[model samples]
Target chain A: MTDELRSRMVELLPRLRRFAVALTGDLDQGDDLVQETCMRALSRVDQWQPGTRLDSWMYRIAQNLWLDRMRAKKVRGVQVDVEAAEALAGPNGRRVVESRLTLDAVGAAMAYLPEDQRVLISLVCIDGLSYKEAAEVTQTPIGTVMSRLARARRELHARLEGHTREAIPRQQAPKPGRNT
Target chain B: MSDTPDEKTPAQPIGDDLIMPYADGVLAPDQRPAVREALARDPELMQRFEGFLFTRGPLARAFDAVLAAPIPERLLEAVRGPTPQRTRPTVSLLGSVRLARLAEMFRVPDFSPAVAVPAVLVGLAAGWLAHYAIGIAVPVDSRGVVDTASLQRALEVTPTGGSAKIARGLSLAPRFTFATDQQVWCRQYALIYGDGLEAGGMACRAPDGVWQVLMSTPPVPGVRAQGPRPAGEGPGGNTPPNNENVLDGVRSLFKQGDVLGREKEADVIKDRWKTP
Candidate 1:
């Protein structure tokens, strides 16, 4: 009800949208999901105890709402809501070289992961949450988050490089010769 | 470990578990330097780290662009709706409890006719405090003080009827903030509900931040036409204009400047008064 909380929520939208985009795998539905999450948060502003992390709470809400939609879609026999998947804006060259990986390849590879694994990857790898924080967001134990994130990163890497995950060893394997 | 078998590292080999966190920079601070040293020594480990970084870096960066993109207006409207394209946003989708809270915070209802009104007057006239339906008898000394502790705490934290949490579950909210010509900081606060009307009072902060009681409204309407007694006879002059039951003769002794906004009030409470 107060502007302090409401304004903080407004500032968190872009980042929230990013997480949503990653979770839903489509830009448009993710935006819709973000909108729904914001509405729910605003209506229940009292539920958030003052002085806590707004972003984490928002991430939790977005995650829950996304999972709920996934369940409902399954019940209704629905597949990917591809209509809203139009890429928002393509990669910009201005970013530092390290972050220049294209969304198309990553997005395609990410599609292979289950919903939970994708969420773990989004939180830790994409959004930069620590395992403890990601666990808090995903409502899992730290050990589970760590293992899942490791597996997810490995799976995503293998998927992107056109190799089976078993072909990659944990220790010193022949390095891929990509010039990046 | 990778099975290249051609090269072996001198240091303890990094495990599958340690590789990602090291690349992600989430390894404990003490562990990072050793891991970094090993990463430098082992090209395969470095490659693995690079692979992990590649997985994270571009996706994170691509999403960072989305972070810069305009948050759709629909989302902003949900947070605070009816916003002007430029300045103040319009009132938003307020919940019923919050709406009630806002109402309670703005107005306090007092119904202690016995303590608020003269005993002889209570006998002679059934005033609005009595008529409003609240009858809690507070011990008001000659200074017109009732529930001083509740009054003081209400002044400090529970500024609104809905938001304030005071002793005994009674709620109070600040309605107006004004500085008297004497530079004394003062505000009007109300009892959440007694009988059916809100009983509000004005208090000025003493030099020590203690709020010295100035005056209180008997749970009567601020509007004049609804006055329970005639203009000359009833407590007149200071009845809030909106309450129809308050008489015209009941006046407040505290001379005040223009009422301040919520932020201005917060500033005054923090002893940072600036003229509007």
Candidate 2:
């Protein structure tokens, strides 16, 4: 790896860990995301220019790696039961158990959001980035980013309020309700 | 968890841009009125909206844990691996310095109530104790109790001419003396030794008529003249009240000395031994 690449990796680790935590909702998974991002960034040394944001570049790599993992799992016929997935994540709650319950509920709500919503929520909500910057990172138009974020907020609110009825298997909902 | 509403209401027109900035308290000053107006219109939306706002305070509380996460030494070592082999000396030195400063600015302290409280408390206590050490004690019964004997006995009084030496090296002792004229004594002590110690010392009467430091020698020294006390650097440095050592002394007084299990006797003596 180039010296620049090595320095950049060192600089990005803390933020990478944060993003990973926000993405996977697990410390170990977050670390893995960071490690994978580092490995990919190092291996594809030519794509990184010196002047652009090293943080953003590495985040792009991480997002791609995380998305690829999700795609691979789907391809392997493993569906993501988001509710079940949420039950398994951590860094929950706040002050006492009460605080923690609040955190977990929020986490679960965020986790069950659609993939695009989840990514943008992680970017703008958990990481406190500006909407414009989040748009650039997600590689979507600003308006699309706003719409997705708005929808994400709605979904998170629904989930936290316990309005997310158990995920009814697709065939169970009225057949005509599939008008997406 | 069950207390939450069963059905999620259709969300109001709160936009991500508006909600996010509002939650962060980053909205421009003029725009707050519009957001507040919108929030007032919907109760359910307001609750969800407040959830995000309330979460930030707790999240800021929890953010300290991020820094506290002990990165296993082995993991850090693995991450830092073979540093000698990949030496890149060509990076501009100025850029590294700027980055280092930025990192230092954002670096979080170790989390935990014990660590955080003590870090601040020790410094504050140190200031107060240092002041109390050389500073004279004043016995004032601000409430007009006139119980000079109890105050003198609490200090294990020794006759020193017109005044009495309540135990010397009292770092944590309140500024007021246990006497009927406590307010007078506290004012006298403050006037004499208030310099180099806690500022604005005043005497007061406790609920039980015992006189005590209204703002007992704060645990920390005053902001001015606050530099280098270990080697006795400041004005109060020469006679810095060693609370740590004196606290140990107090502990020893009960452990090896004759202060424990003699509460009534002490109180009796405290009430009888008046200053000359």
Candidate 3:
């Protein structure tokens, strides 16, 4: 192929890293994910049939890697409320310091999701892959993909709503120090 | 709302397939209104979708950070092989290595202003000499005029293939002529001399306008040939023994007024010899 693929890698690296961060939820782990992705890409250079979308191929590789790591760990981590994180993150870090704080919060929230949900969310929501492309990467049926997506959405909604409810005053609860 | 402690909304609930795509703004424009309507009625649902999108943005940013992280020095050194002793270093690492080396080179034992000045001067002289030598050895000009006088003027000289039409004196009179050795001529200032089947000589023109031979090969081969000898040898004065003999014959002929030389000189003097 032309230097196009190699040059495209430089442009893709940051985006790939973002995918990795979403997948792994820790900066260092995300870096490892990126490294693994690059190394795998290099070693299996032959598998990449040219003319196909490179970003999709790379996202698949990252998601696959995340899945493999989770399977090996066999430890399920608690999923964070994405809305709670966004309320703190505020879209993106337009201001340098604010951005980093937001990034950290986002990272924490991403780490909170179950591995499958996190991967699917990053692929479809973050990287903007279509369900068909995500199915192709995840090696699942489109229907199964849809079902996992539904469960992930409901779970995220409950977690966010729960945090919002906890933040505001509840009519049922009285002041702890005062006797009614 | 009271009966649904464990029940979800009956609307099949927007799956990640729909919600995620909607969050990315990748949903078809016509389909966005439907999703927006769903979001409007459900604050909890809207919040979840926003969270999905906002977290996605930072996750993307973190990836950039990882990629932008400075690569370790060891990795760079590994990429560019170690420099061998006594061989010139190929600092193929980053573009910054050369500047570092230059800074290091500037530091010397007992470094002084006097030492540095003389060292720089000697380096310049050596560089000029090397360049001059290479230029003479392989002069690369292709536009040099094919004339004995112009050849003499050239710092480097080579042979041209066609007829050598050398302009002489002030009126640019045509003088001696010869077919070329090769099909190339150059205008570059370099000493180009070659003698094989044809014995070439480097000719330098004197201040007095007479062409003098700086170097030449003998006309007679080492082994004496039995028949007829050569064209410029015994009886018929067609070609001279070498370029020197040609110049000498031309000068003598000018002195004797047998061929035009002084007439050309007089015109040159009149045209160019202004006192002030």
Candidate 4:
């Protein structure tokens, strides 16, 4: 790789780290993922067009690698129950509960979301990618990106707000005999 | 109600579809006035809007901690490629200068928590007794090779970025693997002691199937400085730096190529690190 490309990759490391951590829901795993992503990007350096955005290219690689890992984990039948693990914290249970109310609460709650939603939230919310930009990276329609993003945000809001659903007035309630 | 209906439907409830876009500030300028009016008039719509807006800041800041944390030396090595040979007439001084800077960045106080004696001789004696009882210490031979069965086994089986409990109160976590210019595969790992002390180093699998300890740092006082702290906190602050000086010392060992991926590393381990 050229010196300029190497420096650019180094500069993008922080943002890549952030996206990876949010995707993996653990710091070490995230760093590992980032390392793998860097290796892939470097090995395929010739495939990357010079004028194109390197950050987006790296993000796509990280996202694909994470999804592949998750698929392989599913095949191995070793899916971790994050909620169950949190409940069994024993002495640290209270601290875990209290941590849910802090700034890190959003990150903790993000673990509950499905992988697809987590990716959208990480791309749009955390990394400051525009909806259109996220769509391009993920290769989804902009409308789908917006709706999925909206649902993910709403789910995150509900999770962070605790169990009691907020009393928002519904547009219309189903009539008693509507179906009948 | 007028006989001719208007396009502006004031009674339409602003759902999350609209509220989220508005809160994200992605809504077009023409659509903002109506959402703004709705948000001003309806308390429920305002609540939903605020809900969507709340997570953006905290979510962004939550992972800033990861960004602020020091980038592992292995990752840096992967990026910079192999260190240029100092003996080469065409090699630039910039490579050595960068390595010097990295060494300076990760410099820690010279104190090994394992061997250090406390003021209380009783505790020291008991600690030594426990250490002997466990027999789980990293003993480097004269040639700087770690001669521990547990460590060697852990290094052999543990994948990159995965940790294995080698003995009581000691865990070994391999960080990454790279090949030297001579095609020697060296793996970097952190040996975490129970009392929040961590020692990081690299071990290369010699042709004879022994993991020769290339270098190891003294046990630093923190087990991964986690959570959100201020950005740019370096050597003096609470953030624990990884064993970067070890990488600096072994810079010439790295080859100009990609670090081994998961499957490739697994294959190397399965083949017992033999030449492929």
Best candidate, lDDT: 4
Q: Residue by residue across B140-200, what tens digits does model 1's lDDT show? A: 2122333433344456543321245232333455655555555655655554442334455
Scored by TM against the true chain B, the candidates give 0.35, 0.28, 0.26, 0.42
Point out where model 1 deviates above 4 Å.
A78-99, A161-180, B1-13, B33-44, B84-276
lDDT of 3 by residue, A60-100 (tens): 88877877776655545423434434443333522122434
List the DockQ of the predictions in order: 0.25, 0.07, 0.09, 0.25
Error of model 3, residue A41, in angstroms: 2.2
Task: Sort all candidates by TM-score, best to worst.
Answer: 4, 1, 2, 3
Best-fitting candidate, scored by DockQ: 4
Position B6, candidate 2: lDDT: 23
| Candidate 2 chain A lDDT trough over 10 residues, lowest sum | A171-180
Q: Give lDDT: candidate 3, residue A111.
A: 46
Ranking by DockQ: 4, 1, 3, 2
Interface RMSD (Å), every candidate: 10.3, 16.5, 17.5, 10.3
Model 2, A118: alpha-carbon shift in Å? Answer: 1.9
Q: What is the C-alpha local distance difference test score of candidate 2? A: 0.44
Candidate 1 per-residue lDDT, tens place, A34-125, comes to 98999888778888988788899989998888888877776776644322222211254121122255555466456556677788888888
Cα error of candidate 4 at position A112, Å: 1.3
What's model 3's overall lDDT?
0.43
Q: Is candidate 1 or candidate 4 better by lDDT?
A: 4
iRMSD (Å) of candidate 3? 17.5
Winning model by TM-score: 4
Model 4 per-residue lDDT at B125: 27
Task: Provide the interface RMSD of candidate 1 in angstroms, 1 decimal place.
Answer: 10.3
